[model samples]
Target: MNYSVKNILLATSFQHKISVSIFYPENSSNKSIIISSATGVLQKYYSRFASHFSSLGFTVYTFDYYGIGASNSKSIKHITANLNAWAFDQAAVIKYAKETNPEHKIILITHSIGGQLMGLNAEIKLVDSIITIASQTGYWKYFKGFSRFRMFMFWYVLIPFTTPIFGYFPAKKLGLFENIPKQVAYQWRQWGIHPNYMFGHFKNTELYFSTVSCPVLILSFPRDLFASKASVDWLASKLTHAKVDRRHLIPADLNIKDVQHFGYFKKEYQDSLWKLTETWINENS
Candidate 1:
């Protein structure tokens, strides 16, 4: 229940400002980590989740993606938005964590698309471990006819046309696009697809899954609209290491109707994740 808040910036050069925010644990014994958010909301929205790790003594941190949060969404205008660039941002945050908290253990808690992206460029190596929650693994409805076509449109047309206009549509009209960058929006559409959309990033995400060496924990929900148990298991199978753990299929007991993807951040399951993280960190680290 106790924490500290600090504004952060990690830059390659004095001119490039990388914005981030941190929540440090009370009576801490652990070091630090980077928590990647899903499509909507700011770094602060994950505060309760971060509090779990921080409260257990680990410093928890998060940042806005180039066109997402508090960071330079403007880069969206010029750079070609792709999966790799986001990994670079994550790597930068890892670097900053190492420099800022020299000796604390480091971990990567990547959610959704962030979890699927580590293998794009091949340079990620600082985190001690990784935890991917409700992340996309693969989506080849066995490469059926309809699936392949959806992939074509998201990658070739619709995303290319629409992302430049909407980077991440907010749940409650979050004003997430006031400073929308054309290029970033374009890239997001290419990467971001409705779960049931034609064909999702099955091959690419699996490729990245194979390359990550750190201990990994893959949490998947059975009722998730975005990711399924089969997808998480596919990712786990690809990891060369045996350290991959599974938090299998958390079901939402919600009165509403769905236990769908990204619900780990919702009111129903956030605390469950907190407990899982706390217990996992305690047992493992």
Candidate 2:
């Protein structure tokens, strides 16, 4: 179970440098995993999860999207990053993992927007399988009650008013999320208002979803206010060709009080919910 951790810098097609971390076990294995983080969530936050996967005999890779975390430029305001750029960055990371471990199966584990953006990756067909955790489309109508109100304020009011002043979304100051790039904020705002979410904005969205033929496992929590069951179902409905396994986790079934959108990734769930995740990956991947 011994593993080594290393940090490296990768260059995008446009020559922008991105920060990536690799976790490899001492013994080689034929399975490798790429952990794609949620929006405004840093790679560092997922380091524990990466290490856990590496200990399980699978080489694990985690990276920060451009204009976020360690990958951001010296002046974030000057950086122009959109959803396409984020997908390209993820694709570049996948390409690196495949080339580095040619014999290993490349499995993708994505969270939130990471799953939504998979269609944007030109190299997605190269992946063996995908596992989406709390992933869903962000259409405002899919949400109800307090969650809907919160989404409205976040997308319509906060993002619009702050980006003009800070030249970027001041997520950290507002305690919403990590600071986000202006373009990312704008694109998210657009997607949130549309009934189809990102599908409405991305050209050839259907084609992108159709290209993915590998099996997909989607795990969602009943208590997740952000990614409701309806939202997650909408995402699953789009991947018509893929053999999709969608499961809803009830905290009571797991002997836990509650599990939210970000709770599953926390260290406290390492033994309970995390073990369930490992079991699914072992069976599917």
Candidate 3:
């Protein structure tokens, strides 16, 4: 079950060089996976998950969006990476994987904002299937009770006020996430206030979703504050042409107390939730 990891720099069409890492088994196979990270999160955060899939005999790839992680060459304050630009970086990685493993069936595993921006990729049809983990629209109203209030403060009060002053989102200082580019932060803020979230801001949103016909597997955790059930449902409803399978995970089912938004990627859930993910991928692939 040994695997090898290598760091790569992918060149995007927009003249940006993105940092990417590939994890592959000692003996390769015809099935490969691309792990697209959530907004403001680095590629290294998903190293363990990529290694797990690599051990399962699938070639796995993880990359950082432009102006984040290894891809951030200059100061984020000077970068203008928006959602579309991030998608271009993602599409470049997907294209590289497709060309490198021409015989392999590529499966895209997206987390959070990764899923929301999938429609922006022009090379999306190269993907054979998609597995969205805790992916949802970012409309703040989707949250109820205290969660709604917290989101309101976060989107309305915190982001608008701080991002303008800081030139970028200093989420790292708050232990929320890696520092985000200004455009990315502003675009997210715009979505947070919109009724349809990302769909409301993305151009030709309906056409984009309609063109994605590959089978999709949506995974969500009940205790995940950000991607609530309603938000996940809203995303699923957009992909009308895709054969979608939705699964909700409860910590109790795994004999645990809590599995929050980022819990599924943690090593502790490898035996339970991770195994379930592998099983679903195997069955669907």
Q: What overall lDDT, based on C-alpha atoms, would model 1 receive against the true structure?
A: 0.61
Q: Could you give candidate 3's per-residue lDDT for residues 203-285 as a string of tens digits?
A: 67533667788889998888688888888888888888998998787788779658778887889888988898788777877
Task: Write candidate 2's Cα lDDT for 257-283 as tens digits.
Answer: 687788877878889877887787778
Pairs of residues at least 3 apart in sequence or in different chains that clash in candidate 3: none
- The TM-score obtained by model 1 is 0.74
lDDT by residue for model 1 (90-145), tens = 66787778777877777788787677556552435666788888776435331335
* Structure candidate 2, residue pairs in collision: none
**Which stretches in model 3 have alpha-carbon errors above 4 Å?**
203-207
Regions of model 1 farther than 4 Å from truth: 12-15, 73-81, 121-123, 138-157, 163-211, 252-258, 267-271
Worst 10 residues of 1 by lDDT: 168-177
Which candidate would rank higher by TM-score, 1 or 2?
2
lDDT of 3: 0.87
Relative to the unseen true structure, what is the C-alpha lDDT of residue 43 in candidate 2, on a scale of 0 to 100? Answer: 96
Ranking by lDDT: 3, 2, 1
lDDT (Cα, 0-100) at 119 in candidate 1: 56
